[model samples]
Target chain A: MDNMEDNIKCVTCTAPVNIAVIKYWGKRDEELVLPVNSSVSVTLDQAQLRAKTTVMASPSFPNDRMWLNGKEQSMDSKRIQNLLNEIKQWRKEKHNGDTCTDGLLMWKVHICSENNFPTAAGLASSAAGYACLAYSLAKLYNVEGDLSAIARRGSGSACRSMYGGFVEWDMGSQEDGSDSVSRQIASENHWPELRVLLLVVSDQQKSMGSTEGMQATLKTSQLMDRRIQCVPESVEKIKEAILKKDFKTFAEITMKDSNQFHAVCLDSCPPIFYLTDVSKQIIQLVHAFNSSCGITKVAYTFDAGPNACLYLLEEDVGRVLSLICHFFPPDKDDLNTFVQGLQTPSISPLKVLLWT
Target chain B: MDNMEDNIKCVTCTAPVNIAVIKYWGKRDEELVLPVNSSVSVTLDQAQLRAKTTVMASPSFPNDRMWLNGKEQSMDSKRIQNLLNEIKQWRKEKHNGDTCTDGLLMWKVHICSENNFPTAAGLASSAAGYACLAYSLAKLYNVEGDLSAIARRGSGSACRSMYGGFVEWDMGSQEDGSDSVSRQIASENHWPELRVLLLVVSDQQKSMGSTEGMQATLKTSQLMDRRIQCVPESVEKIKEAILKKDFKTFAEITMKDSNQFHAVCLDSCPPIFYLTDVSKQIIQLVHAFNSSCGITKVAYTFDAGPNACLYLLEEDVGRVLSLICHFFPPDKDDLNTFVQGLQTPSISPLKVLLWT
Candidate 1:
């Protein structure tokens, strides 16, 4: 303990992305990052898509510093500062030691975070990044408690990423947002046969970042209130489907929620369009494929960007992927390409022939 | 009447297209063509876009026949039959002094209808076509009170085109659609300075015709109920805007209703996409242009097709058109070109400079 300059405690943690089956669109409380309604999501494996964070605390450090995906990010944003300050306060309160002076609690920290996947459009990188940051910092300080609320302060969906597997962020009725915390509905291994495929396409139009976009929708979208009313019941139904392992019901609800979320985005005053023609083709292909199968075999959802996240069962994956490949036939191996033209990769002819 | 082949009565009438500032999306009565809510529209001059119909009744005609845009069309659809049958019934009922055998009522009619505008995407060609058919048939039979209700039998929006200038399709509470009819809000000369530019975009995806699209929305969209509750009030506000010549309010409501209509379309099960990336660019351009002016100088609306119908004052038309031309310049004089790439014609740079 005498060599205080050498006292460096470091922790590295990784967190995965969560695709919302029941989406969180508008926020009732902007500063607290509370959603308008409860939402259900499926967390992907960290190896598939994730944010890895390394948090280091030392007496030698001068001040709090942070880096995101290599470049230094501003620590001045109100939300980021609120998160950092809250963690610092929690470190002191959460420690159960009786030491006269816990000098490490006052020490500044250096944080570095990066995402492994490059195709990051609407992949909820912020959710993974924030959850990783909170988890790493909590480990570094030897703190144990619910970190979901801390993650929620960073991004509304980040709270759902705090747990591994099926999760839900209940939009609690409270003035202080204390009850608005995420809970694990089921474990990652509960529905082992389910899978999600992410198709990433770069966007030419830089959309209004989620923060401003949510605010705009809250103010302008006429359908926002209706969506808010509908989602709580939807969350319950999604939970029931998840527990029953009803892929059909789960898939149907997920696609509907995604469509409704974007619906209101278009309903906004100036309007917002996240789905590119390619994203739309993927959508059309999924519906046509499902219709041809005579049952819901596959489902698709899109976040704030053009990338499409598709969900399907293990049994149907091979045929659905084959169908997607035959129609969409990637121009590149990595699946990152700039799409052009309205030439609908018409799947009607193949729809009846291929899915069998 | 002995030489009945030569004793033929003929009538030719023309009708203009109407742009719905307040849109009607859902049908409370699908067969009766009764809308879920009231809607208001602005009728364009027939000189700009119109449907000309020629109706002739003669004993030489063996059977009832119809031709649309020079091509033969089946007279079998229930909606078309209902419209034709209603006119015949009205003709027999309204003849002030008639012998038992009117003779002309039994004679089969040959109908021909055509639209002048080639850029018919989302331009409400069906509205003009149906309105013209109703008007011509009414004139041929010398039976005239209000033909809007009869036009409603063919297409929901067709009733709105029965009047010139601002018109309102009051969705009356009647099980039989007896009270549901279009009414004139203001004459064609009410707002002389107002102008609309039809930016026709050919769609690669054949959308569900409005009838089917409306049914799908009524069945699937959660926003449809909210929209139904909202438009009756919107109809009042739009009428007020037209009466006062408040271009700002009128433009704002028109854009909102258009956005909402497309919103519900996107929210439908399996979803429906009417706006192409090119269509979305024009939307962005309109919003950006209006934002730059700091006063609502322009507005845009889209129906079931990718084409954009922009509304602006006569004084502002040149600037808006020039801005559109510079960015989305026509590759050909006629301006029908296949678009490619996600190249967002970014107007932010020119938004400030050109509008000044």
Candidate 2:
């Protein structure tokens, strides 16, 4: 047998970020991390926006240690503690009377995580980071029951990042929140023609975190309470729109829900304003662009920050992209690098040439 | 006797502008110009923002002729027609059994109107214009049942401008809207210490007029439906706050209602954005200023335009003014002209010197 230090068992995993089509704004239970309404999201390609995590366990380690990016973080965060405790309990139950393979369950764990995209740019970096951590640690400790539910313990939205394509998180009714989980609505290949474009309006960290912001909304906004009441029906409609692969209904629902989320934000006491001037201009531009086409060819959704995530069909992507560049021209040197992510390198400049 | 043309009957009146603290957004009856919810407003002094109207009826005039400011305008506008028709009908009833002083009531009317402030700047120039028109026309025709009711037919908000100081426009339950009218809540001297500061963020015409904007909101925003349902209760609280001279409660209600108005704008389909970067900066500045003081000494509200109207006490005016000038310094040449309206010419630079 190898030494305990030499027996450093490790597992690595990568998870993609997700953008909500129907947003989750308020929560019913802060302790259980239960949402007031269900939400739907699309997982970006891991190659474009992803978080990579590695977990190593060894008997020689004194305690659990975690590093985000290159810097070490405190293991005392309650969210991290919840995820760890839940996973350990699952492991104990899975092998109640059976022999374990590597004795990794009892070993102290060390976790490291990093994201390719800008963190806290309203790109859901936390979701990907927490999802990757849960995936990697579960693989390392051989804990396998309801991974999404375990990820939800870390970040409410993290559960949705566990799957690709369209996914919806049901804001479960159970008092224990045992039923609150993310389920895949469609596979990545279900709508191959669809494309997403993120406009990084700003890289600044948000003044208010989503958790604190939602708490304020839940407490103060009467409109938020009303919004939550209508969301259950909206969730069903959105699911149907996704299954039908109907872009019009999907785009309308996505844009309307985004607007309503921001509306509730504004209604929140001491109101949270997430959309900046650039964000408003983008919204107007999209409306104008759709009006010109006489159909909804594109849709935009903003999270808790100013960045705009636009969705469009593959055929219309070039046209809308060209229009965006024209309306919001980048600085001379920044033109070439104006856009980033999966479509940038693959789509030829020739495609935009015709649009210009 | 004078020549027939010299026998022209004329009357002129000036009306003060009104700023809605509890905004009236949607119209229940477009033809009647009836609001879906009640609203309250503070009537500004005519020395600052006012509309002056002169109506002359002469048998020599072939048809109704109208002039806005100095330019001749078509008399075909339905809003203008509504005001004229209502005033004339009132005249016929008042003198049906008595001999009229002159046959001026049978003559075609020639009207001239002008506003001290910029029209379509969300300063409610139309409210003042219609109020002045209704007032002047009533004086000429010697007809009086309810001038505000006739003004409401011209512009829904104009009804609020008919009264001085604090005014409330009741969204009457009557089907004919005969009961819908403006009533004075308090006299102009009720709170003499209260002062208003208008920051002219922009004088540009709004992309969507309030009428069209509200139509969109009523048609599309479900949040707006819920908002209207709560307005009757809000109106009562606002009335109580005003009567009690409770600045804290008054300011909180004003700020929250303003934010809710804009929130519904965002919830509208294809969303209407009325606030600009400057408007947002002003909001944040006001919040920061209030937070520093540990009390709500000042309150800011925005209409459809980007301009911000701040309310504060006379004692706190100088310090707040200095702070505003510091954060939003005008060009050196514009410093003298920074503050507009009634307070501009009367208040010397010496007043601001006390704080600076």
Candidate 3:
């Protein structure tokens, strides 16, 4: 109970979740979002693309109000509503200030959310948005549990979003999922020089959503068992590769995992076709470009859609970026703006200007 | 020792090779056509579909002549021709006959070859044709060296065609390719009741040739190395699965290997795009159909193109055929004699009765 106008404060927080080259496939418990094995992912920077969430609570308001990506949504959904109720209950029990009236039964909450990038794209905007919403609410409500544990409820991959760096979600054996949580493997500060070049190929929504596709794969794919068993080993290798900054090992592991994930997609009962011609072309061109330049290890990963996210070493960033730009040359009208936007203080100003 | 007509007879033979569920990706040596690891394959029945070759020689003819398919060809362009010459020379020397001076050298050989099925439609027609051609020639010329060894020089897979059943190509480490030969894993008589349904999704030639694609993959894909290294283990598993007649293990290994092969195709520098929507649909339908029926396994393999070759358990053969026919209904209007001519005997009798 609360007269929340005086006690509650609206706070906005945002974050971005990364894709796992070593994908998470089977679940130990579907309801709990507990995976069959541990999985690792790299957290992307939140400067240009992220999920923005604003959480507001007040006694003056009538009921919980929610907006997801600018559209009004029902708080009636069991999952979202349950989380909201839990947070409200926590806030009421914790607050002892006079700002909370003794007779107050509820505090109305309004949450607004949006993403800087397209939600329809296979770029996993929902993963980032849901993870951000959970993290932001946890901070606003002063929730006590571990961030990863709370985020896990939001989405399976959301657990990895709690940390702002490389993270690993360990699919623990506890039946209650109490031990299934993410741990920070490496921080962004540790890899400050690393850069990711995102090639936004298609912004259209995927035909089969990840959850549905994964469920289908578990049911139909004969290969799913092997893949599930293989993930733990892949996770370990990826962790070691990232820690050592071994781009060769990292690239190899990442590419193999991505292919394996897509293989599982193909292995799904009534196989899910995700990668389109454009997606395939991007893969082809990336390899060709890398080989042509004698670059042994630049990593490219694709999600459920056609977009490509290329990870490049700091020293080779400029050359790789230039080659990418030249190969995937933007529309004449957008070229100048595209080139200018990629400019950073540390990059050669002359080179950036030359592109323009 | 001077009479040549008694020593040589005109004979032609043809065979079809099966694509492995576990693919052979890289070569140990291009010159020797030696694979980095052992590979397993199924041999399609000759009566249903195979390569057709005709070999003819006469004293009236001039020079040893060779024709491939329908066109006149030069022996110089083909490596197999040189190998044939070596065999002929050996036969002459072994017999201690002046057959070369008895107008036998003046007698020419005319050879014509054709495939009942689509060429390069993921069917391994070339392997069969070359193998049969070489085998038939060995018989015609009475070449003395091992037939398997001679077939190996024609095509890496041709050696498998020398036998009439399941064969495994031993990827020996010997640089001379002396030990790299094929051996029968199982005879057709061992699984006499088993049947294979070949779904000709498209008869069109593949856009990307396997040889060119393999070369590209070897030059660029990082996954190629891993694939080559990993195939030996899969081969062992597949062999054991086959020997045990374990359909579940067999199907699982086959599907996983096919997916991995295509994954390598995607991982290639230029990316080899082989499957079509129809091919993907077939894969999906097979998965869904099998899963819905609670059948854990049914094997399907694709080669360089979209056509699907499904290996059904003898018990499920009728059900699968009916299902496939129902889903991919044949166009009655487009049913010409050529299409009608190729129908399986089991289906042909029913079609004839229905038409009458």
Q: Per-model i-RMS in Å?
A: 0.6, 0.8, 4.8
lDDT of 3 by residue, B19-54 (tens): 555666667777667776787877767766678777
Q: What's the distance in Å from true for residue B305, model 1?
A: 0.9
Could you tell me the lDDT of residue A266 within candidate 1? 96
Q: What's the TM-score of candidate 2 when only chain A is evaluated?
A: 0.92
> Residue A45 lDDT in model 2?
87
Q: Scoring each candidate complex against the real one, what DockQ results?
A: 0.77, 0.78, 0.17
Q: Which numbered prediction scores highest in lDDT against the true structure? A: 2
Worst 10 residues of 3 chain B by lDDT: B347-356
lDDT of 1 by residue, B5-62 (tens): 4678888889988888888888898888999889998898776578999999997889
Q: For each candidate, what is the lDDT?
A: 0.80, 0.84, 0.68
Query: Mind listing the fnat for each candidate?
Result: 0.89, 0.79, 0.15
For every candidate, C-alpha RMSD to the true structure in Å: 6.0, 3.9, 7.5
Q: How well is each residue in A1-356 modelled by candidate 1, as lDDT tens digits? A: 11223688888889988888888887888888888888888898776578999888898889878898888877777877777767766766766534424777778888899997653444568899889888887777677777888889888899999988899988888888888999999999898878776666553444778888888999998888998888888888889999999989999999999999999999998898888888898999999998998999888988888878888876776576567668766555434332211122333222111110
The TM-score of chain B in candidate 3 is 0.84
List the candidate 1 regions with Cα displacement exceeding 4 Å.
A1-5, A95-101, A119-122, A203-206, A332-356, B1-5, B95-101, B119-122, B203-205, B332-356
As for candidate 1, its clashing pairs are none
